[model samples]
Target chain A: MRMPSPKQTLAKAEMDMTPMIDMTFQLIAFFMVLLNFAETEQDARIKLPSSELAKPPEVALESPLVLQLTKDDKVIFGGELLPISGLGQPLSREKRFLELNGVDPKEATIVIRADGDAKTGVVQEVMQLCQENDFEIFALRAKQELAEEEP
Target chain B: MKLRNTGELSDKVDIQMTPMIDIVFLLLIFFIFNFRIVVQEGDFNIRMPVAGPSAASIDTQLPIRVRLTSDDEGNLTGIVAGDRKLDNFSDLHQFILAQVGNDAGPDGADNMEVELDCDYGLKYRYVISAVTAISGYVTADGHIVKLIQKIKLSPPKKPS
Candidate 1:
């Protein structure tokens, strides 16, 4: 048998790190693109009702006003919690703001995020209040219900 | 010490990669920690002008009324579509499908509207289910065929 070469024994073991670094960079890029920094106006207190027909709108809503209705019938708008009765003043303010900005309150979308457990009456009341403020368009927000797996 | 010639340079310049790899790993970890798998949310749009029935277009016909009633605990008790009583949402969907059919033109569903008349004490989930039934149904292949695009609410009844 031939003896092993001394040069081969003396050489340091090296790993080709190019492939690993390339893969790591690819993963980082993938995450960077998918990262969502936009803060959606969602409140944890309201557990939205789920519906199979509620697909996301193809066209983005223009200047939507998000209102979260808690189970207890309180409305959360612009980070302030108020009773359904007290929503009129804030709604008026909102209408005025829209007028000042030259946007029609009728064109503005009021997105209602009502709790699944909330009373239907309260949701209607909120809608009525929005109508009083001349906010004609309303979007009832619902969680997307995942389809059940077939056997 | 013996001095090497200044004119002679090494064939390969070893660039240190440890710090770069460390920083890259930190970034990956940060993103992984902050990564959130958010459930998708959707909306049901309804145009209800301040002016009650007068807001409706003159050409459009009367809206079909679907009533939802509930018990004291807010549980859904009954569902009525116009004059017919529906046992459940599926029944309501069938009723709507029979009425609307496939007569929708290229512009989508007809100009028909569905008015939701829900009881004050009813849970919102039932109302959503009713809306889901009235709006549309997803085919087996996951395609959504819209039924009625125009939906409005009837005047809310007082909670008993």
Candidate 2:
């Protein structure tokens, strides 16, 4: 049986959007927890060297220490310039503190982000310091793309 | 067929969009603040050849040493593998594979360890190319396998 259309139904159209809005909020929350801002700690002034053989480490360090080497021969640690020769004292202190806090110094990783033009010797000094402090793992940061070489 | 508006109803209830738009804007701002732009800086896990003078040394086997030398301008001048001067990255990869052999070790260990001694001045591009070449190989079945699983970095020699 064909019945007459209701006047209220023809006057307005309304749709529920609560489900979609809930999904959007969930996505936002997911990214907020996953994004690790500390990982992008490269100094803008330092141009990283590139390597084709360089692959991302299998496991990432939770609290890997960062050190930067500039072309001017300055070793920047935590934004303060430190002498290449004097890096040992602080490094040892860091290791000692890590030990006190129950973190094994041997398990801790140190990442070195150095400029290509920086003297190899200066970079080695930092590596040597890390080695002397009983730290085993070290990561040398390099850009993966060959086309992105800094002019 | 022409129809008449016989069932018209009041449509005066306007939905408020101001609060919904404000919430969306707030969510967008939150994402922008928390998002970290990852600079694809490949972390080449180059462990030191010698784990300092602390741990007792293991006499497993001698690693194939590939020395990379650079000029004062940080230009990669030479790539040498025990007296063989390789011109390109492919040669470096081939040379290392030739030395390691096609068959895996009896213990299923790739056993082919390479220690790279790279110049600090040498751009990372060269190092990575050489590393990429020597580390993995394409099998006859078209499968890729890493030839040299273990890689160690030799400390840079001081520039004279």
How close is every model to the real structure, measured as TM-score?
0.83, 0.69
- Candidate 1 differs from the real structure by a C-alpha RMSD in angstroms, to one decimal, of 4.6
Question: Native-contact fraction for each model?
Answer: 0.84, 0.48
Residue B151 displacement in candidate 1 (angstroms): 1.6
- Interface RMSD, all models, one decimal each? 1.9, 4.6
| Best-fitting candidate, scored by TM-score | 1
Worst 10 residues of 1 chain A by lDDT: A35-44
| Candidate topping DockQ | 1
- Give the per-residue lDDT of model 2 (tens digit) for B125-146: 4665676677764455544566
Please give the DockQ score of every candidate, comma-separated.
Answer: 0.63, 0.31
- Residue-by-residue lDDT tens digits, candidate 1, A25-94: 9989988877776645767788989987778889999879999999998999989999988999999999
- Residue lDDT tens for model 2, A18-106: 78677777877777887776665667778877654455666767458788888777788877788788688888888899999999877
| lDDT (10s digit) by residue, model 1, range B1-160 | 9987687576977788899999999999988876776667899988898764655545566788898888998999998998999999999999988778644555435578888998898999888898899899887788888888788887778855
In angstroms, the error of model 2 at B73 is 0.4
Model 2: residue A14 alpha-carbon error in angstroms:
13
In model 1, the clashing pairs are none
